[model samples]
Target: MSTSTAAAPVVADERVASKGPVAKLLGRPEIGALVGAIALFVFFAVVAPVFLQPSSIATVLYGASTIGIMAVGVSLLMIGGEFDLSTGVAVISSALTASLFSWYFSTNMWVGVVLALAVSLAIGFVNGWILIKTKLPSFIVTLATFLMLTGLNLGLTRLIGGSVSSPSTSTMDGFASAKAVFASSVNLAGVDVNITVFIWIALVAVASWILLRTRVGNWIFAVGGDANAARAVGVPVVRTKIGLFMGVGFCGWILGMHNLFAFATVQSGEGIGNEFLYIIAAVIGGCLLTGGYGSAVGGAIGAFIFGMANKGIVYAEWNPDWFKFFLGLMLLLATIVNLVVKKRAEAK
Candidate 1:
């Protein structure tokens, strides 16, 4: 050759490309939801002047916290690739368990609380166990659970409490203490913010940490991405999935307790369709129907969006009937945006 010297081969590392801050931001699962939340906030601020008031904001946050608390577990379960159609009824079931047991047994309210927890965890365990054994889609498994719990909630409440609602436990031992923990409010800058808001924030922080920092988090993502592949690689697919379901049950328990203490009674039919709301929040938060991609923070944002829309309509004095229509529209739009953002992130 000319100089009998060839330049050493130059190998390009495909994975070494540096992503700018904007690129990184666009890569986040919740970025789309964040943008949507901001736009919604501004839209409401323009149309509904009262929405910006501290009192109204507190109310909005309270509503969001209720949904967001459950969204935490729902988000994680989704990340692990499963669904629980019984979540709505499951919550009422837990509340009913505590109220009925305490009122009937004439025991400390705390006793029923502990028992309710056991029952809740048991329901989740059964759902998981059946799924693992039968290999049925989560939909069928939880739908069966949904129906069973629904019947039991109504039938048992009527059988024991002699009504469609649980008996009032407001006078029971520990009622005051339990209510303080679950339903009380904190005065923040003169606004009475519900205790649930703090609980919701704590849950999101903890869930986010698990998903981003821990081995279990990795297991969740791995199993959700490809259970067969993850299993081949030594991931405990069965355990992860089951744990996720149980996590959902735990969340239902917390919310159920809140409902019980906050109101002292729960309607057997109260939670009938709320499972869809939880699913909608998760989906709007960037979770995939096919699973393996989402965040707790995204779910919180989704819940915030729901809170805004739900109250924004009232503030703006629009027909309340239009809410479902707006909810559907937002869900469709958010899903599309999340998909587009994900595609772009992958391309980059």
Candidate 2:
């Protein structure tokens, strides 16, 4: 048996009869991120008078929704001990594919969306399969993918659409319905909330359930924590990792659709550095660099922190150049804090 499985009962014994509430709370992967988020929110709200306004709230939610969608997937994959540097470019690729396909074929918009989904999932599978087969580091594998997708995004758009951006899909058949579902906003007591906010929230809920309640969740944690050991204990390590990558692809599809519908066009060269933002959010939200422990809710909280900081910087009248500085500072701080928390959790 794997070390984790062998020690499961001892941990359960501690859980049921030894560790108190304080220890339990300390063991939570998201606790540090949660605390940090609250602190960041308060700091921003106190300084930026408009930070708490309804419109500002909506803006934060919209921004968070974009990154949060990807953060959840990244967090899960991180828990599985891998990274996908191609995610940002992949989003653009998916969007471009959908827009161009729908326009060229004169088909229903949904057809293009489904095709995009298939393409994204296939890319994910290739990434996962190649990594497992070649025994390569995920960083190297995805870095190559990132570069390839970047070239493809620009090259394919020019070759097929004669521009750096795909043609507007706003007028395509079924676009209105797709927009209403993915990009529309609803008013709540005069405050407009983006539909993506709802989607992000639902995704968090579902991901949390999967992580905390399902057998697959345990498998994910096991594989990330120690793949060799997990395999020894009968975990399908390869399948788990591939599924995690595909989950990321699924989120990329969702975000791609939203981006295309929201702006009515997909830029071939868009989404270059945004992968860093998603990773930073996941890291800030409590996913460890070594993986094996993290939370979906933590990632959501991290995205919220990013959304708030992004707009809060503007609202506070800070120089735009400092945004990257702030993000990097947060990432470092969160990583240090997560390490300390992990130590505490493992301590008796």
> In lDDT terms, which candidate is top?
1
TM-score of 2: 0.94
- Candidate 1: tens digits of C-alpha lDDT, residues 1-348: 322233426453445565789999999998888889999999999999999999999989988888999999999999888888999999999999999999999999999999999999998989999999999999999999999999999999999999999988999999999999888999999999999999999999999999999999999988888899999999999999899989899999999999999999999988989999998899999987777899999999999999999999999999999999999999988988999999999998
Clashes of each: 0, 0
How well does each candidate superpose onto the true structure, as a TM-score? 0.95, 0.94
Least well predicted 10-residue stretch by lDDT in candidate 1: 1-10
RMSD of 1: 4.2
Can you list the residue pairs that collide in candidate 1? none
Using TM-score as the measure, which candidate wins? 1
Cα misplacement distance, residue 243 of candidate 2 (Å): 0.5
lDDT of each: 0.92, 0.89
